[model samples]
Target chain A: MPTITVDGRRLEVPEGSTLLQALDELGLLMNGVDVPHYCWHPKLSVDGSCRLCQVEIEGVPKLQIACDTPVADGMVVHTTSERVQRAREGVMELLLVNHPLDCPICDQAGECKLQDYAVDYGLDHARTREPRRPGRKRVELGPTIVFDEERCILCRRCVRFCREVPETGELVVENRGDRSRITTFPGTPLDNPYSMNVADVCPVGALTTRDFRFKVRVWDLDEVPGLCTGCSKGCNVHVGVARGAVQRYTPRRNDQVNETWICDEGRLSYREIGAPDRITRPAVRDAEGRMQPVSIARAIERAAERIRAAVLREGPAVVAALASPHATNEDLTELRRLLDGIGTATSGAAVVEGEPDGLLLQAERAGNARGARDLGFGDPGLVFEKIRGGGVRVLLVMGRDLLAEPFLGGTDPLASLDAVILLDTHRSALEQVADVVIPGRMLAEKGGSMTNHAGLVQRVPAALEPAFDAHAEGAVLARLRAALELVLPARSEGAA
Target chain B: MVSTLVAQAPEATVLSDELRAAIDREIARFPEPRGALLAALRLVQDELGCIAPPTARAVAEIFGLHPAEVLEVLSFYNLFHTEPQGRHEVRVCTNLACSLRGARTLLRELEEHLGIRAGQTTPDGRVTLGHEECLGACGYAPMLRIGDRYHEELDGPAARALVDGLP
Candidate 1:
């Protein structure tokens, strides 16, 4: 470690750390200097073309770009110095000279680094009489990215990103001077599994995602730390919410998992948030075979009464629960207690097989398959077969509609069951057929910890309030346990 | 204001035996494979007449680099044409010394004779003409380069003779 003094504060940074990283570590990087960077993404290789991170080192002859300058022992650096400020102003002035000034229509207006730095360092108006440089706008660089050349500052952040990460190298700086723009390979779409990360690496308004470009303004979003539940990788994410729905999911920096990057598959999974088929209210089948909406309390009480009657008639062997591999640890634990309380140890989470992508995506698609395994659950496929063989008469489903699986799809898996209790976030094929369908909160509307396939537990906070009359799956399970114990005098609370 | 790239990818190209051997020789000279990219690309351009996307892919395959990486280098330099190079390349200097000595007029005359403008290939595909900023023969004002040879101390007639002299 080398000791360096930045802006009058002395601190020891790790050896081989750059001045910018050292300043960032010391917390001395602030004030009118603003962000003072464009091309230096923490994850990508540094291309110091922006020249805005200029700092006045005491021994250096010229203002050195902080991102490219290595820190030395006893080196004194000044980031808020007059020379550094003037350099930043000059850089900002030159950067804005050829800008289209279309911030009003730009999707990156609010959160753009160019916009942020321009506020503190830019001139009131352009000084040059020459017209703004003519460059192409709305260039579809690839299937996922839209390129606006004029907005680019020749920073090469996105170019470096494609070259380094994903190792695709699809994007390149075409031409030279003012005509330079990010161009893809002669003919290839930017559909690499992680191509959307380029838009996240771009600090300016140049590259914007086709999916989120005009859908929602960034400032309107309420960010909550969450995880991508598409797989057991548990890549941490910032769940962007607006109008009570998930607007987008951007990668959150979790070095243990996804390092400031998420796969395009997980990024676009936000589109499934408020699908039309989502279950909004709990429903119970009427005598006429129609699913009629019922109060949540009434639905739970009716569910308990039906289960008690089945337990008293067919004994505990007639009942088995199908647990969700996607549920949180708290919910899985509660589900375990509920299944045990009923004296039926028969349970299994349905297992689906797929090859792992060797990146953030894992072989296990469920977010908490490891949690389910650790909490003591079995194969849900076996539970369905048991129901078909007349061993189990009643089935309680957590989220997966195992009865709808192909093996049981032809014949009604619910035919042998006297009652079916389904708690699901989305409407399924078995919804109308199930005896009771309880509306459950979506993963984005529930808060708990989930252990990934690697057993790394991460907190998944609710970004939006539970939609309609839904409850957290854990809350429903706890209430169901309370309801079941009321009749089973032999089974007291916490006795299971 | 919408744009999109094709979902389909361009096919990769295979390198010729001699070009592959030359590329290996170039790669051996440098510590890293990428260091030989420029030399390898020039060799490919020489062999294939131009470093088009296919040839670029071929060179990239040899250098273990992305095709776009090779294409970017080709795009940055004015000499590495991406299109099939004409049988002959005619370049007239349009720098300060050359332009002052009637180089622009000579270039226009040549364009008219060749039936094409600077930076364009003739319809017959016999010659490609362009103006350079400097050809490094400033003493011979308004000097023009034809292939590897420089035609210097020239006027309209001699320049025409030199251009017509292309076999």
Candidate 2:
């Protein structure tokens, strides 16, 4: 470890660590110190363009950018030296001369680096009386981003991202001197799946998300770290909630999986979770075939009695379990245990398959197929084979949308079975065919865990109450396990 | 419909020889011929009032790209304009930071003076008023990008005068 002094404070840091890293490790606020940075995200590659991270190395005459400059043993760095502060303030002042101050209605308010730097460097006063040069025409970059030329500081974060991260070179800075502005090639829209991230990474309000424009202020929303349920990939995300409802989804950095980027589908999918069509209550079929609301206990008892009778009539071999990849690992484990205890053979998990566009949507439509496999459920075809065999007379379908399957087609899969029990949150074709339907709670309404494609288990905390007499899949399975006297192992412990 | 079609035609002639020469210098920098399309379009837009269809088609032809491709690219990026505009274009950033600081009020004032909303050009072609999501100059919320210049710390009156002063 190399020892370094910052702002008169002495501390030892590991060799090869940058000063910013050391400052972060020490938990010292680095805002007041003169550090010129643009395109140097702590997590991303260090291009160090803005020359803002200027710091005084004890022996060196010229200040160095802390981000690109690595630390050496016995190095004494002065981040708050007058020379360094003046250099940083000069760069910031220049950056703002043409830069627009639109914080009031800008989406990046409170979180923008320009605001933070301006406040910290005390460059609030404008010295230049010259009229600022205007930028090019305002361009609608894509469905998600709009470009303003004048306010751009020419940091090139969006340019670097398009060129390197998404490999979609849709943006580039054109012209020189007063003519320079970020512009894309003619006919090329910024249509990359990760384009919205550029808006998030822009230090200033240069890049903005189309979906979030004028919707809600960043200060008005509360952010909750959660996993994206868009697909089996399970990208980590922060769900922004406002007024008791989710406003948007932003990617959370996870080194093992998404790595600070999420697909457009995942970012825009929050609205679907809170959609009005979501089934909120458990319903049972009456004599007239109408789905009537029932108490949670009544629904559980009805499901248990039907399963017991079917097992008694046709033995455990006659009962089949149709699992869904959408259920969490804990819920899957409980359901498997309950089925096994009832002498019903375990069926493989069912998953919706879609075209893989090589972005984020996997071939598997369900978000938790990998988790179900981890919990010992294999192939859905095997379960179907068992059902087709003479022994299986009843089936319990959990979370699978049976209506979408060609085998069920217009007919309900449950209609063919002697007894059908459906546990799902959506009123799909499976619910219609099911002899008994139990309204299941959504992932946002439950405290459980899911395993993403990379086998990372992510914990999801309940954010809202389940609507319409629904219960979480885990709770419903727990109740069924109790009725069946099934013993299952405790939740698997690990970080997701 | 006829007026819109007429508006879609080239509002100005192709880039002048001087602007074309400047663009050609930029084109020579890239190994790939198509790499300079963005620079060329900016040059063309600078020379002409805005990017008209014929002007875009000429630029696309020079770059060996389809006119439709050039139009798509022009429409996709915010810097290029497909339609005619006022002598000055005033774009106010309305992203998160600016929104919190009241960029909306500044934008409304600009629109009121120009007598055109964001994304529209004034009837007299004096100013094209628009709202940008973010211009990366978040520290100065309520900022406007006019012509090739950025004006920050703007009040309603200041923003209105800036647009009104455009040639």
Instruction: Output the number of the DockQ-best candidate.
Output: 1
Q: Against the unseen true structure, what C-alpha lDDT does each candidate score?
A: 0.81, 0.73
The CAPRI quality class of candidate 1 comes to acceptable
State fnat for each of the candidate structures. Answer: 0.45, 0.00
Q: After superposition, how far is residue A390 of candidate 2 from its true place, in Å?
A: 5.6
Model 2: residues >4 Å from true position, as ranges? A1-36, A42-45, A70-74, A135-138, A355-361, A389-391, A401-411, A486-496, B1-167
What is the alpha-carbon RMSD of candidate 1 to the true structure? 3.7
Error of 2 at A494 (Å): 33
Worst window of 10 by summed lDDT in candidate 2 chain A: A487-496
Model 1, runs deviating above 4 Å: A23-35, A378-385, A401-414, A492-496, B1-10
Of the candidates shown, which would achieve the greatest TM-score relative to the real structure? 1
- lDDT accuracy of residue A144 in candidate 2: 86
Chain B alone, candidate 1, TM-score of 0.90
